[model samples]
Target: MDYLTATKNKKYLMYISQNYSYAILRPLQQEILAQGGEVKWFLEGNEVTSSFLKNNESHLLTIEEVIRWSPDVSFVPGNVIPPFIPGIKVGLFHGFNSGKRNRKGFEDHFNIRGCFDLYCTQGPNTTSRFEQLSKQYKHFAVKETGWPTLDPLFNPDTKSIYTQPDDKRKTLLICSTFSRNLSLAPKLYQTIKTFSEQGKWRILMQFHPKMPNELVTKYQALENENLTFIETDNVLPLLKAADVMLCDTSSILLMFILQRKPVVTFCNQDPGKHLLDVTEPEKVEAAIELALSHPAQLMDDIESFCQQLHPYQDGLSSQRVLAACNELVLTNPKLKPKPLNLIRNLKMRKKLNYWRW
Candidate 1:
């Protein structure tokens, strides 16, 4: 019997190690449940808050429990998944590539960790690169299914649990990456504080979870009538509410730009015509003004950039992802097998204390 035909009740495991994974995989989970598939979550580390899991959502607490559950497939948003997990491991990346480089100066986004059996790429830029890597690795498959996280961003009917502030002020969202060297949080602090003091825009500041608590506290202190600091795992609502975004090299900026809205980025690593890249803190105010103005050329560049990044506006990427997974299972492509990855697997086993082979 074919894989899809034989499986009456498909069991899917959402393997998460970070808080952001919840937002990335929830849309896919919704699709799974709608299709009569059983979906369970397996949170590997303390970083992922258990409370985020809904009452109806099931979670496997231990590795032993996961082994017994025997899922048909596992979706991982983070880089690594234990090879011991009994499933076809699929990589659902946590975020878009924001041109951040690793310590070794290599593009971290395209780095293959020898774990996933398949990669559901976001768009043409990522798909073309992963396709090239797929050819070289010959171990995994690449499918250009849009990122599932943005399903709600594109879906107008989807009601957000988050309520934007009632104020009618033009919202200016400020976000920064956690990377110290790449972050503009510290550098642009005075400028943003001044902006809040002006009370011309409603400043909504949110930083990456991994950002230093000291810096977070510093920004939190800037809260006043004009400024509000937001802390949440899901940033979709904020993306929709904001008119203009001021960011550093964080991938969240990419998500904001996908709305075809203008963004003012500070010293972006890969500055493009799509963004209003400002070098100095003093230039930020002017950049924000230009972005808010929505210049004809700038808006055109943003639209063109978004097309290459994520063209799917239908919000049905989750369905496409499921279809891709089903097709892969049915075909059972004869690709090169994944590496043993003994060191990585050993580290994972030690972390989980699962020794049974």
Candidate 2:
């Protein structure tokens, strides 16, 4: 039988606690609906303000309500899967692990703390590591499914098309991560300010939502006729609009590479050959020029990098993820919620105020 035919009425409980998680899981939620499955969202703590729930109010349900529903599968983009939640806890992950900033903790990215019954990996870079860890831990099933969040980038109907503005100046997008040590914003502000004033390029700046409001305000004040500051959960549109991407250690650098576009990184922690790493402030302008002047020069390297990162650029990753979920639901015995991690549970309850005598 076909995939959708098999998942006609499957139930999916998506647990999200941040805009980043919502963005990562939103595509899969839509795909579930298309497959005739019932998908409900449970926002943890402050995630209720997520734009995903803005239009999807009807689909919102409380955590208690979710438990009673006992969905066939519970997907979490963030690290911790809710303790005692019914069904298979699947780790869908939030972003690509580019090994940026010398981050060695799996908890921040790939660590499985008995939270998930299954893990959907983005590519070999992640899958190989998780597979080893899975064997060592003897817990959780790992599947190599390219990130569902990026599926829309490859979809013909949904893919963003870049259109040059009327003035014809190439668009430059500068994105920074939240980590102050790795973020390029504070250090590059003067360089960007100089460039923004020149009017030689159309500049777009996007920062991690977790970035402090003080920093955001500091950058927002820099907006001018040539420079625009963007603050939104969705980045695909911005990615599609830019002719070149300037970034630090953020995984969006990998996404930009997948677009076959040139990316200039500011001393990326986990440096990739394709990315033009610029350390000196004076060299930033020259790197941007090189990218715009010779995009063809790096096409081969970018394609090779993308192949190792995520080979399925055809936009069906969401389908594959849903298929895996459905198959596990039908074939595997219903998973009984494992014994709760008392410490983790208490921490979560305190965080979400789920206290009950």
Candidate 3:
């Protein structure tokens, strides 16, 4: 029997680098708690704030505190596993957009650099990719558990399509990746502004947490009655709230696509026929109108695309992830000591302002 079905309690430790990581682990944490499992969160870096602690009700753990705790499993969304931590290190992934490219071939999104003992993949595409990498690297395991961050989206009772009052205006969510060259924010700001000012639509803008501060400030100044600037780490609510999402080269586009809503991508690195691809900033307005006007035309394509990402729409993805982790704990009872990389650890410690001995 799985931990959820078993009558015993287990412990889960979450390693988070930023506030946005909470979205990826919150659903899993809820599931773990529901299954008589306890979870403790550790902030992995020094750039934390008092406001984060107050909002999350979690304390920051030093490297010593983390080692002393020695959790059964450590869930991380970022790449670094943090040297000398005990337990099964699991990478839950931050996003599903893996088909893009950097100067290097294939962009290395799903590449396993031995950071995780197990990876809870969002869907088949990611799983298949990681499976190949795992075979080649001869370490780590891949589990096809859908992303926990999107679990709330599949729940009917908790899913809210609109947070705003019923003004009956069409809602458009604008988002972008942090890449300056790939992001559409700089190129399409004027176009978005023009549309928002028309009063025909309600614009909700949520940028990547890594987006440059100056760009965030510039967009913050654009907030008004029709346009809302979202700065929160949790985007599940915003993802559910929006009628349509406008983005560029973001896996978030796939999340919105899973909603079966229309998505307009501006200069996406991996443009798909399922999405309305706008290469030019000038064409974004027309694409928005096209999406809002005839979303039904794209329903079949959207569903097909969603299936490739994740087959589950029943909100049990978090449960599946927990099941996978529990299976790892049960089968691999002896914890393997993660090999220490002194240079890497020291570099990270210095960068995050941890004590260097």
Candidate 4:
């Protein structure tokens, strides 16, 4: 069977749970539409705002409607997807693995819960591990297709929302993980506030959607001529706008580093040569200064890290992902049956009120 032909007129469902999933999956949607395929979105959970859906986009309101539509494939950015949904489940993970660990002390990125038939990984760092798990489970396939979200970062045609300030000072993007134990927003608040008052750098602050409201309020209060608090579904523009980034244990730092820019992490869980990891809040300012200098060794380390993290800079990851999905659908390679996952499915059913088997 011709896989390329198989993709024509295909039906796809963008399974979204968080606001950021929009940025991650929209590139793939554009690619799907370009290939003469149909795309629809299914916004799950209350976290995703329905207003984000544009006038041109189509979305199903209920599971029954989703069943009636009967898509050929469902692309999920979040961890869970209902098995009852009629489609080949494909996991397009939300973010890179920035060494964040779960409550059980195990890395959360590599945890396979048997919810997907295939995982289109970001790069070698993730592909190799998922491939090993695929062999062990014999229930899924792994393909390294870079990340669809970063396609706009490299794509020249894509317009960025970022506009340069007239002052032309260096921009420092500050982001933090929501994890209470790993968050730097609280710890570095004073330091960042001082930086803003001094007006040495243009500060842009964005935080995880799940970050504490109190901390968000505090940061928002710091907004001044030099400091700005940003709230948006997509962070790609911010990544492109910043000259340097300050983060702590958040995957966004990894995304920023992919641009060959320097990042300063405050008490990062897994520090490496690529990052200027500082344990003390007082040292953060110095680290930012160092990162701005772009030392030879640090820049080289960042280059090496990017190659391992995500080598594809061609802005065609969406095409590659669609090709992978088409090949899987057309060929239908034999593989072990996926596990029942009774409890998880039960929870999903309860959440969606979808009882039909």
Best by lDDT: 4
Q: Estimate the overall C-alpha local distance difference test score of candidate 3.
A: 0.79
Against the hidden true structure, what lDDT does model 1 obtain? Answer: 0.90
Q: Write the per-residue lDDT of candidate 2 for residues 286-307, one digit (tens) a residue.
A: 9999988756647777788888
Cα displacement (angstroms), candidate 2, residue 140, comes to: 0.6
Which candidate would rank higher by lDDT, 3 or 4? 4
- Local distance difference test values of all predictions, in order: 0.90, 0.80, 0.79, 0.92
Candidate 1 C-alpha lDDT tens digits along 265-322: 9989999999999999999998898899999999999989988999999998988888
Q: What lDDT tens digits, residue by residue, belong to model 3 across residues 1-357? A: 645554146667888878788777888887877777777888866443435544544554576676677788889988777655777889987778636775777566765556688888888767787888767665677789898888888888885644777677888999998988889888888887787688789988999888999989988888889899987877888888888889998888888788888899988878777889989877888888899876665877878888888888989988888888888887874434444667887787776566835
RMSD of each: 1.8, 2.5, 2.6, 1.1
Give Cα distance to truth, residue 354, candidate 1, Å: 0.7
- The TM-score that candidate 1 achieves is 0.96
- Tell how far residue 352 is off in model 4, in angstroms: 0.5
* Model 3 alpha-carbon miss at residue 283, Å: 1.4
Candidate 3 Cα misplacement greater than 4 A, ranges: 47-50, 53-60, 159-162, 295-297, 333-342, 349-357
Clashing pairs in 1: none
Where model 2 places Cα greater than 4 Å from the true spot, the runs are 1-4, 47-57, 101-107, 159-164, 295-297, 333-340, 355-357
| Candidate achieving higher TM-score, 3 or 4 | 4
Candidate 4 worst ten-residue window by lDDT:
158-167
TM-score of 3: 0.91
Which prediction has the highest TM-score against the true structure? 4
For candidate 1, what's the RMSD?
1.8
